[model samples]
Target: MGFLGSVCRCSGALLAIPIAVIVAVMVETPTVTKLEGGPTFEAPADEVPQDATEASKEGPAAPRMGSGSMFDRIAFVYDSTNKWMSLGLDQHWRSTLVKDCLQLQPEDKVLDLATGTADVSILVGQQLRTLGAATDSVLGVDPSSEMLRRGVAKVESSGLDHVVRLVKGDAQDLTSVQGIDAAGTVADPSAGAATGSIDKISMSFGIRNVPDRPKALAEMRRVMRKKDSSRVCILELSLPSGETFLSKVARGFITHVVPLIGWVATMGSGGDEYDYLERSILRFPKPMEFAAELGRAGLPVETITSFAYGAVNLYMAKPEFIGASRTLAALQSLVRQRSVELLTLAMLREKVGKRVDAADVDFSAFGCLHFWIEDRGFGSEVNNLVSAAIACEEFGLHCVVEDEVWNSGRLHTYLQAEPLILRRCPDEGTSRHRPLEVRRDRRVATPGWFAVCKHAKGVSFAKKSKFMRRVWRYTTETRKRIDRLNEELRLPPKYIALQVRRGDKVAGNRKESVQITGMDFAREAQKHLSSSCSVVVVCTDDLTAAEEVGRALRSLGSPAEVRWRSRAEVPANLRNGHWQASYNSLTAKQRIEMTHEFLADVEVLRCAEVCLCTFSSNVGRLVALLRDQRTVSLDITEWTND
Candidate 1:
């Protein structure tokens, strides 16, 4: 009988014997012939000879024999055999392995190890092409020359020979094949510098065939870049073991049906090889255990996903450096301290080798905007900050709010924290560096000129309403507090929101502060309170004004309930000096609480049926910017009924 015919014919007899005995017999069998009177070995014409047994006796650290030679005998029918054995699910699985597991990027340089017939390499090339990355290349390496020869033909036939190259190489010894450089040009692999130059490395259904799996894994890690940008993926068949029906069904098919299909496909030439496949699947480690093995190989597994009832698993990992933990901790610390400017300067120095002239750098390419905040009250500063952010976005720059602005009451709560790049002066001891020019001769010149100048102050609010609306999102804690307050107050369904600016505005400039009075607010509230059910919601910095507005509304015979925050509810720290002074003096925790309260008040105003307030109030302008509801803003002089 032929080699595969004997294997199929003996399958029944082998099943009658204990599995342990069968495994021992298979291991002891001489699959290759040793040359007479020499250490050299020989196998079939297509089979690659390995001296693993001879090498083992020379020292205690001998290399393990792999199943590459076994695959060499079945290379011609490997792809067809897999299709039949997998019942046509192989292609679907491979596509998922490429599209999802590998996640090929447009510029990625991929390395496919044990690329039996370059199926994975072709899929990768196709994915890259779909992503409009025709310049990207895939290098496929396999230990079996016959497999590579077949793969080369497939590459040519698919018209991907330009980007997909197949070579005769071992997974454990990847130093032989040329690798792509940073400029995407092929570099000499023999120079040993190509290691860690690859953007991604993938092994599909091939990790199982390697003899020294850990060493092969380490070589894969060595070929991937050390940064998180580089990823390694492994897709391998797994043995199902659970008591579920699917697991039992898969187990039976892998042990019996898979070998039977292989026997028929190769015309009984690959039954023994398929039998080895069944054994290997059963011997392979579990997903978690294999992930641990990958970790030991210097590729810390990032994600592991199983497919088809755990019969197949995909492992995605990145090269782990020894100091990565420390580096991450330090980076987090720097972020908390808002030292992004210093960090950015350090990175700039590293890239340029030395400090370059600020004029030489094109700041626009960095996608960031930097500007100093004027030392002013919270409300004025916020108006400048928000306008600056809006101007930055309009000019195609991402606004990076200063740490001082981030610590303010409402501004900190509303704006996101992004890093800003500060230019360094050539003179190390110089106190001042060149600031980004927002204006030229007191006129707005740049797109983000509004951030530094007063031009187009409300342009963002008018033109970019959608952008302004999304600029602030209440925190989960603040939202919950607002919801609780809303429930407690049981606010009227139809009410008018009234804002009286008194505290700081009256103290600093009575012209701006006393523009509107309690009687003026009561008269405006009456317009909305046409029915007894209507109510008036009052928000003000002055407790006295809030109380006087409630009395004036009642005296006007308006049945609408007058609701306002009582003085007792206001924190004592927030009641002193101008509202800005009180706000600036509060502790961080107290500031957060005050910010939340302010946001809640704004929320009420935003949801009101109609809003009436003085034009000079920042809260009134902010509310008008956020909501489309009817808003009536009277001048400070009009409030005096003059």
Candidate 2:
């Protein structure tokens, strides 16, 4: 079931040669850089006592090549080995697609069309389960029994039998009659036999193998549930397009190196067989055109995201009419108008903590919760944390900083803000800065003898660099003063935390760079957010960051609400909340967790509003999720700025 034999299952060697040669000539040569080294060399290049001139000799390593189609045949040779190789670049592609393409569910059923050993199906199944899907959610379908056998074996070996199921049948012919048992089969023999609508339908790599392309697509449409809530997904290899210099380089690599690797790996099988691998790639349709085919087949494409520099792409095509929205357009409109912001499961513990109802707290009269660290020299991290809290408050959350014992000069660092809550004055003057005190550090007191500041200030104590010694020292003192003030004021249970990743310029193994990467707002907001009343809504690009804040709040026995940019949407019951927004606004972790919520929110809407923007991470997920929710966009340009 490896690359050597994956393509062999498609056609015999004799018939595969002619196509291979023609494909080879048309196939471009892969460029390889040649390097030369002398025979044996003395230590010094300039002058070695005019004595030694032996040179060392070496050449560039030979290029290894393989084809996209080699993957299909290699399954026949050594499936396990080929599976890992094909997945080298494919793992990333799958992760991106799962996060971007479909609206997931915990228990929803998924049918993987053209399963081809059910690799794609299994991959999808694994992701779904990780996102909290029920184990029985994914099913695999393939035309080849040999391919199906490998999938079955994999499932049994992994003990994932309940999560993934494989059925042998042609993708083009999916009817009950088409499932001929070679003698005793009872499934879809008519091929394309309708199997009703499923939550998700995925066809990866296998689509190109089908002889009747249009028929296979049509069968996909026929079997798909007519509801506006289902997903029809397609992931496959594609050729590069023009207008860029790198385009030629990429083309060269694919045509030459790919086939070369195939020859080396599948040599005994047949060079021509591997040659067909090159032809298939050359002949595959452009992504846009392929998407058009899907539209024609009745599963119009909703999202098409390319990966690996366009070597592969994932297409999410939903049925024309999902649920009540008889047309794809109708579904988009419905989801936009009827999306939810937050879905919360408010909890209480056995401990007897005082209950604060959100309804009873008059924010206007109460003003705001004043939380400030005690110091003149401020901590950058502490200030950032408070800033985040302020931002959350703008969205209607609450926070408080308890401060009493103010250490002069340093207090200003912790108190600086938009409102300038605290003022500066001479220590001996009648106008004391505090509730203030005096500090001997003139470096901090130069501005004023005593200065008022917030009980909570930003600080970056986590930095390990030697340059931040002064800041770290101030942060430590500020925290100590805060503890003293909290005890003096007898403040209620509170949560104080910091976000340390604001300076990360790039993500691990990703292309985009994150800005405004702080979880402080969510952390501080949780302190005052009543465990029984107000919900602490955490919106951050990092879900783990938000969760950490939420966990901290939870430990204090407070109600914390966390949202991610990757989350699908609020469940149907929770859609009425005003917080409903796209996942792009939150962290990746939030988006993932929210996907579970969206999958569970299956309400059919009358009409939905549409917001289209350039396909950004969160925005893309939003569009995909809303489409699943049954909204149709008349045009995608209206609400999106980009």
Candidate 3:
């Protein structure tokens, strides 16, 4: 069986092995820094022979270091998942490993053998591109057809296709390969760069997946020059044995929670995929055991560093090159901050295009998308929509819009705080409240054509609260007031509703206390109205402030209604329901459909005749992305109130 297959098969048995439980109960063991030699020998010190009894009584130790079967299984899973699961951590791990490999020579050429998705290949190609390497110079080789197709699409889409090459080839027999240099110089011009011509070679998340790990390792050694110090870095997940309470909890989460997540993501109906994940982790060799494989392969392990409570590890080895590791120390100081992933249903709608078909849908595009917005006001809803829409249109990617408000300094803390925001969103009427497992039903209702726009933005505490209060009232009372207005005046949809606000009254910017700048524009809009338009409905948080501006604009002979809806007035106003509402409603997903029918009864007083809006407002950006009509940006610089 392949490495991953072995892991999947052995996961249940490994769990039963009770390795972590034993370590958890035992006191912390002091680790000896053994850089000077191989693993400390307690039993007979002579180099352990290849035919030693298998560690497990049931079968020969899982295709010992450098075994071919180990990788074949990984390739199988890689083919099955189509490379969806484990992408985030996989990318981060590869990036650190690539960084280590590149330290060999700022300009050295590197090959990421068995490079699934070309994670390592892309990094190496980037280094060559930075040095101005030509197309067809840097290459990535893998055996999986499915993985290659996806990797090729990514390279082409990223505009890196011209520089990086993704090829299907075996790592065990790479003695005949060629190399590309910094300036696109290929030694054997006919068949591409010649064999034994490459510099550094590294594999990430692939070695453990390989079957005959030793032969693959030795093959890597044969393809490089002897005098040249070839560098190779391997990064993989490991369950390190230690007695810290934190590590024990982390082990439990990995053994249990991780598989559950894997099940939801891979096998949504829920089946054996979760078992695959748990099995893979448990069946995975402990850190020292894996390092011992590199020794067998002839690429002696030089150093090992733990990351994320030893859940993952970065192992650096020299096929021949070994020196006091400078970057290893740097890795110790670097900290990983927690970031929430967001997806917008609107964006997903856009990516899947006008029609939704499971076959047409490329689900792999939905990797984790991070949401960031400058303002968390009503303006945020619009901005969030735009970000999601753009991502879906451009990347065909689905996002997980996180409801994150507070910033925690550490990754673990951020994970803990995420649930708080998710819980608050539904109560605020932003989206229906659902735990992560049930949140899929809360997607925003969008047009059929908009299905591809699947990006998500997190709502902050202050903004989400404000959104809930405003939405509840808007749907309930303010909705009715608009209905009454339409019944009384019989307004047309083409009429305009103008929202104006003072810049001074807005909240302070989170990172700095600088005042926002949309107030002046609102004050200045009165002078430039076209004679064709009438009856501007002004929206504002402060009624007194709205009237002051309304009176000033009225002085210029404009016919507009000046009114303010207090936070309390919303419920009553929505009950009247005789008026038209904005295209985007703020009601919770569950309640909105019923309210939408009421909203439809009211005609839009205006179709939006040249909207004068501030750029800082979320409403402004929303109008920019959604409204098809011509709208003008209300620049504050144009305002001269005097």
Best by TM-score: 1
Runs of candidate 3 exceeding 4 Å displacement: 1-34, 37-89, 104-107, 175-195, 227-229, 268-277, 321-642
Q: Write the per-residue lDDT of candidate 1 for residues 1-642, one digit (tens) a residue.
A: 699898987996777654443343223221111101100111112222122222322344423436667777898799888876765667776787788767778888888888878899999987887777755378887766667777777777887877887765678777676443212244455533177678888888988777767668768877887666788888888886433445566677788888888888889988888887887787676564566566545565656566555677787777666453335446756584335434433443342232111113233443555443422344454555556555556555556443433344434344433322222213212333222433111101222332234333335446534554666566566678777655655677777888777665655421234457788888877876667448788776566777888899889987778787653555764543245545655677766666656677778888888888765666667777777778888554221100
Collision pairs in model 1: none
Best by lDDT: 1
Query: Which model, 2 or 3, shows the larger lDDT?
Result: 3
lDDT for predicted candidate 3 compared with the true structure: 0.45
Comparing 1 and 2 on TM-score, the stronger one: 1
RMSD of each: 24.2, 28.4, 23.2
Clashes of each: 0, 119, 77
Which model, 1 or 2, shows the larger lDDT? 1
User: Would you give me the overall lDDT of model 2?
Assistant: 0.42
Candidate 3: tens digits of C-alpha lDDT, residues 155-175: 766678777876655676663
Per-residue lDDT of candidate 2, residues 123-205 (tens digit)? 77777767777666776766555556666777666666778767766565666323322222346434333477467777776
Task: Locate the minimum summed-lDDT window of 10 residues in model 2.
Answer: 341-350
